[model samples]
Structures are given as C-alpha cells and as structure tokens.
Target chain A: MRKLRYRFSSDEALMLAYRDGDSGAFECLYHRHKDALFTFLYRGCGQPNVVEEVAQETWEAVINAASRYTPSAKFRTWLFQIGRRRMADHWRRVPQQESPLQEAAEPVAPATGPGDEDYTAFEQRVLRAVGELPADQRDALLLREQGFSLADISAITGAASETVKSRLRYGRTQLRAQLGDSL
Target chain B: MSRDTRREQGDALPLPEMNSPPQLDEKILAHARARAPQRRVTSRPGWMSGLAAASVVGIAVMITLPGQDGVHDTLPAPHWEARERTPAALSQPEALQADTLTDDVAQDARVDAQNGTQKDAQKGAQKTEGASLSAAPPKAVAAQSSARQSAGGLREEQARPDAQALERKMQAGASAKKIGRASPQPALNAVAPEAEQSAYRTPESSIERDQEDRDGATHQRMIEKGLETCAALLRSDDRPAAISCYAALRKDCGDCTLPPTLDAALEAQASDSVTSP
Candidate 1:
C-alpha cells in the first residue's frame, strides 16, 4: 500500500519523504530516474565504467545531503546538477588522454539481428554524432534532449540562457552536417 | 516556426538505450537504508515523571517545615545539655516532656530568688514543694514506663536527664529558701494554707500550677493551632504535607496528645509512604 502510494507522488514529495526518513520513498525515486540519469552520463562521458562511477557518487552525495535538503528547486534538476558536477570533477582529476569524440568516433559495430539492423545502426550514428560535438554543445543538446527547459539547462550547466541556446544551435547544426542526408 | 522550436524539432532523434546495473542499485539502496535518520524520543514514561515530581515535592516540604527548637527550649539548660550528650535521649520523648515541666518549675524558683518578692517566693516555694511531693515524681515514673514501651526502649538513658533536671530544681529551691529566710514570718503565713490545699490536688491540676498561668495558656494555644493545621492538611487530601505537619507538631510539643482520628490518619499515610514505590 505504501509503495503504491509513493509511486504516484511527485519527485519533490518523494525526496522530502526520503529526507524525513522514509527509505521507500528514495527507492521509488531511484527507480524512476535511474535509466534517464544513466543514459545522460553514458552519452556525456561515452564510457560505461565512468558513467557507473559518477552515477554512484552522485547518488551517494544525495544520500549524504538528505538531512540538509530544502525544496528550493526540482529534485530532478538538483540531481542532474550534482551528476554534471561529479562528471566535471572526475574529468578534472583524471584528464582524458584524448577527446571523448575521438574515442566515440571509432565505435561502429554491425547489428547482430536483421530485425533491429536499421534502427540500431541509426541509433548508433545519432549517439556518435552527439558524442563528437564539442563538450559544451553536447551537454546543452543532451540536457535539452532530456526535456529540460532552456532555463533549467542554463541552471544545471551554470551558463547564461543565451550561451545554452547558442550551444544547442551549434550542436544541432554540427549533427546535421555530419549525418547529412540520413538525418 | 521559431528558430529555437525548429532547432528543438530537428534535434529530436533516436537515443541509445541504457540502464544502471542491478548490483549498483542494491549497493546505493543499502547505503540509503543504512543512513536513514531515526525518530527522536521526545517524552519520558509516565511513572518516571511522576517519581520526579514526587521527589521535588518531598524536598520542598523538608526545606519549609519548622525545626525542633520550640519544644526543646522549655527544657532547663543543664538537662538539655545532658540530653544532648546522650544519643539515646532523643528516642525518649515522653521523658523529655516530663523534664520540661519540671524544669519550668525550677525556672520559676530562680525568678523568685532574683525578685525577692514575697508573693512570688511563696508561690515558688509551693511549686517547689508540689514538684517534690506530687508533680515531678509521678510524671517521671510515667515517662519511664512510656519510654520502656517506646520503640527504642531506652528508659535508663532517659532517666539520667530527669535526675540532672531534678538536681537543678533542688538548687533553685535552695536559692528560693534563702529569699524566704529574709522575711521568714510573712513567707510562712503566705505559703502555709496553699501547701495544704495543693496536697489533695490531682497531678494534672498540680502540673498546671504555674505562677504565671498566661504562659501555660499561650503554650496550650500554640499546640492547638499546630494540631488544627495538621488536621486541615489531612482534610485537604495532601498526605505528604499532612505527614510533614504532624512531624513538626510532635517535635514542637512532645507531650501534646493527638486526637485519635489524626493519629490514625498519620499512621495510614506513613504506611502508604513506606509501601509505595
């Protein structure tokens, strides 16, 4: 009954409940956002291992900060903001040997099944194009793809709204140029 | 279409499918569960608070009640001193009361000696004679019997202070006799009839033969007031306060007899205090 009740609760309500010592609320919240957050990190960093590490650290930071949490902003925006900062700190501590775009540019594997061939190939192409864009443009485009408003993207990335708009425009233009006729 | 909307529409493309591993979910959830905040304990148990309140009230009653000096003051100095030296004397309250009456008579003799008033000297001589003949001996014997019946059973230790008080009374009588010798003829005439009449009197009336009956009447009024206070406390259903008031009464007036109902109430309250947690 409690799980069913929490399932329909808003993200902020669930987070407040977790802050007030209901672990079930946190479980409901984690399951709701785990896939989206993992995809965001994986697309940002282009490495499965780094995605898992940064995601775990981000959730750990959330758990440690539950006692002090106030509902000043949406829980989703706060979560993605922490994920973004952890990803940035990881890159700062261990600088990439080469650009993430260069690393993603080498990733074309043929689909195993005929039924998923066309869509899988297209999905990989789009992900690769998104990964190859400059880091700021890619982050803006990805966060925009995750359905954040322009203001939310600006807040998460700590950039001006115009800067975020410019990044999204340039990123889409680059993806269009790279995957020209297919897009 | 607007430029930003066109860009947003153009960027809507298929994304890769991904999810975090089950093992990592288990690990983070375990950490969250482990770090969950515990509810605070905000109140104590009912009995605990009751016990604390009772202890505070008991301490306040002990601090506010009167001391034992009022009853002990009427006793002669030498007798009080000797009783203070003997630890067992404290347990013999009846003997102390008997000693108080005897010492008051002695004090009257001393006052008569200093004043050299023939009337006071005659009264003093009569009281001194009454104490030796009719008042002091019977009360001292009754006090010894009561002391033997008391819980401590210290009759012999109680008798020692009475003997000291009696010797002091003899000294006061000798001084009064010296004053009487100054006007031997008139003093004899004044005391002769009263001495014969005092012999047939009861011990209670004899003990009431103070030269200044006003002092005895005032002491009786104080004892009555104290007992009334004790009775009022019991009527108000404040057992602890009633017990405290009764204890003060006993300390102030050791010989003052309590009515039967108040005595029974005090016993019941004392038993309840002993039996309760």
Candidate 2:
C-alpha cells in the first residue's frame, strides 16, 4: 500500500512542517508573509537600511525558534513579535533619525491636478502623518492596518489590550489633525 | 466616535512597501533547511511530558524494591512470622480450628495415658490396705467394684473422664453406707451414732452431713469459677490468647456454654483475611 502524505496550509502548520525537515513548507510560509512583514517594518521605522536589517533578523529569529513554536497564538502574531523586538533593538543601538513629517515637508515631483496625483499626495500625507506619531501609536496603527485584532496587537506588542486600544485612538486622532481633509 | 471606528479609519490608509533585501530571504531559507534535519526535540506537549514523568517514577520503584538477586548462599524459606504479623493467606478459621484441635487431642491423650498408669499403681496399693484392715459388706463391695469396672471400660475407650469420675464417686458413697451399717469396728464407731444408721441419702438432717454437703458445694463452685475464667478470656479481643482459650474449652470443658459472638468474630476474621488477598 502507498503511504499517505499531508499538506501544510496555515502559517503555523507550514512552520511546524519546516521544523520537521520539509524545506518546501518554510519557502511557502516565507513567500506568503514576507511582503506584508517588510511593509510593516518599512512603515514602522521609515529607514530602508534599518528596516531591511530588522526584517532579516526577525526571519532569522523565526527560523532559530521554530522548534519551540507552539500554536497558542496565531503564527502572524509570533512573526510580528519577533519583528517588533528586532526593530526595538535596532532603535536602541542606532541614534534616532529625522522624523517622517520632516521628510514629507521636503520637495518632490509636482502634482498634476486633483486626479491620481492629488490622491497619491493625499496617501503620502497620510503615511507621513502616521509615521510622525509616537512609536507606540505608530506601531498600533500599522498592526491594525495589517488586519491584526486589538488582542493580537496587544500580544505582539507586549502591552495590555486596553492600552493597544488607547494607542490606536491616539494615533488616529493625531493622523486626522495632521492630514486634515486628506484623512 | 468609538476607538474601533477610528481604528478602522486608520486601517484604510495605504502604507508604502519596502521589501526585504533579496539576499536576506536566501540566507534565512538556507539556515532553515540546514537546521531542520538536525533539530533536537527539546520541548514536548503536556501529555507526553506527563507520561515520561510517570514512567520515570515506575522505574524508580522497580529499582528500589528488595530481593533483586536470585543467587544467594542461603535462600529463606517461605513461611509467615506469626508474632511479627498475621498471615494474610490463612482465610479459613476452620483450618486453624482443625489443626489446633488435632494438637490438643494428641496432648490430652498422652496426659490421660500417663494418669491412667499412675492411678493403676495407686489403686493396687489402696486395695491391699482396704482388704487387710476390714472386710466390706459383699453387696456394697460388688456395687463399688462394678462401678470401677465400668469406669475402666470407658477409660479404655478414651471416653470423657469427668463423667466417669462422677459415676465412681456416687457408687463409692453407696458402698460407704452399707459398710457403716454392717461394720461395728472402732473406725466405724468413730462416726456419730446417728451417722452409722444413715442410708447415704442426699443432704439429710445432720450437722456433719450438712458440712460435707457444703464442702461438695464449694468444690462445684470452684469448677464453675474455672469455666467462667476460660469463657471470659475467650470473649476478650486478645486474639492469640482467645484462640488458646478455645482449644482449652474443647479439651477440658466440652460441655461449657460458648457465646454466639465467638462464631461471628471467627467468620469476620475469615472474611477479612480473604478480602485482603
């Protein structure tokens, strides 16, 4: 009789399969979340060099801790926790750079009209407004954008659920004032 | 507005992407592949860990048990230490009673044979003295001799001795009366004049007879006192002594009354022994 084979579909399942010596499962998980994870770090720090370094370190930490990964929380939550930890460590090691609001004030390609150009400008203004907020608020807003629930964000950030809710509220209020009608 | 509503508004904003450097993905995947085949299983689920702990406890118990070695210079025999602890295997009181009964009967038979031999020697001496001193009335003598003959026949058959002794005493009393009437020797004259004419009836009107009657009553009281002592000891909770009391009653006082609770206690003990094993 032929032996039956199992397929890994979810993030946790794939990571566990990779820990059990299936290299293909790890590749599947890496492709699935790499773009979203990189975007989160990029928006989080706004320094491409630091973002790349932290993202690399986060993936490395995931690989190293794979054998100990329990499904107590979502795989996405686990992935982002390592990403946030690495970002925190990078900030601790390097001096703080100019904030994104200052960078947004600098000149760029001129706008054509209130068409696609105006919308792009509005999107840039929103990003800059989000990036200007305090680090806690910015992280809460970014995790919320990535479709994480308040409880999951709390777990990833190591803050209470109520605190995550307050940070998100503050972040939105600040971004609304910064962007005005663009919000 | 609610925090969740504001959160949804913030979530609608488009964020610019800065993808991970191509080289980093290659690096992590390479490491994951290399380590996957060599990963050591360090952590286990709760049930697996619990099973491992239970197995370890079982192994520890097996290692700590006594008598592991098979080859010894002297092997101990398998038997219970009665004084050290009661044997759980003795489930039947009937077996214990049967064994103790056999031991008691053997002991009594040996003692009875010895007493019979000694009594025969003493009887020969007493008969010679009686004949030389005085001749008893023939009728009374015949009656006493017949009673002794009957006792001897019963003794040979290993019948009960207490009943035989009572029969002999009664017959001897009858013979003493006839001798009192017929013989006028000084030995008979030493008795009171009214006593010489007495028919050896049970407790008649006489001070001397009454005294003799009181003495017999005292002897009977002593026998009753012994029976009560044996019965009281048997009724007690002291198990080893009570078992001995049972054997004594069966041997010496076969007709003694035993409380119903004795049989109940034996049955309870037998059940306890059976239940444990």
Please compute DockQ, using alpha carbons, for every candidate against the native two-chain complex. Answer: 0.31, 0.26
Candidate 1 Cα misplacement greater than 4 A, ranges: A101-116, B1-11, B40-44, B47-277
User: After aligning candidate 2 to the native by TM-score, how far in Å is the CA of A88 from where it should be?
Assistant: 0.9
lDDT per model, in order? 0.64, 0.57
Error of 2 at A73 (Å): 1.6
Clash count for each candidate, listed in order shown: 0, 0
A32-134, model 2: which lDDT tens digit per residue?
A: 8898899898777666767778888898888888777777778889999899889889878877676733454332433322245455565555667777899
When summed lDDT is taken over every stretch of 10 residues in candidate 2 chain A, the lowest stretch is A105-114
Please give the range of 10 consecutive residues that has the lowest summed lDDT in model 1 chain B. B182-191
Give the CAPRI class of candidate 2: acceptable
Q: Name the TM-score of candidate 2.
A: 0.44
For model 2, the stretches where C-alpha displacement exceeds 4 angstroms are A1-8, A100-114, A118-121, B1-11, B37-277
Q: Evaluated with DockQ, which candidate comes out highest?
A: 1
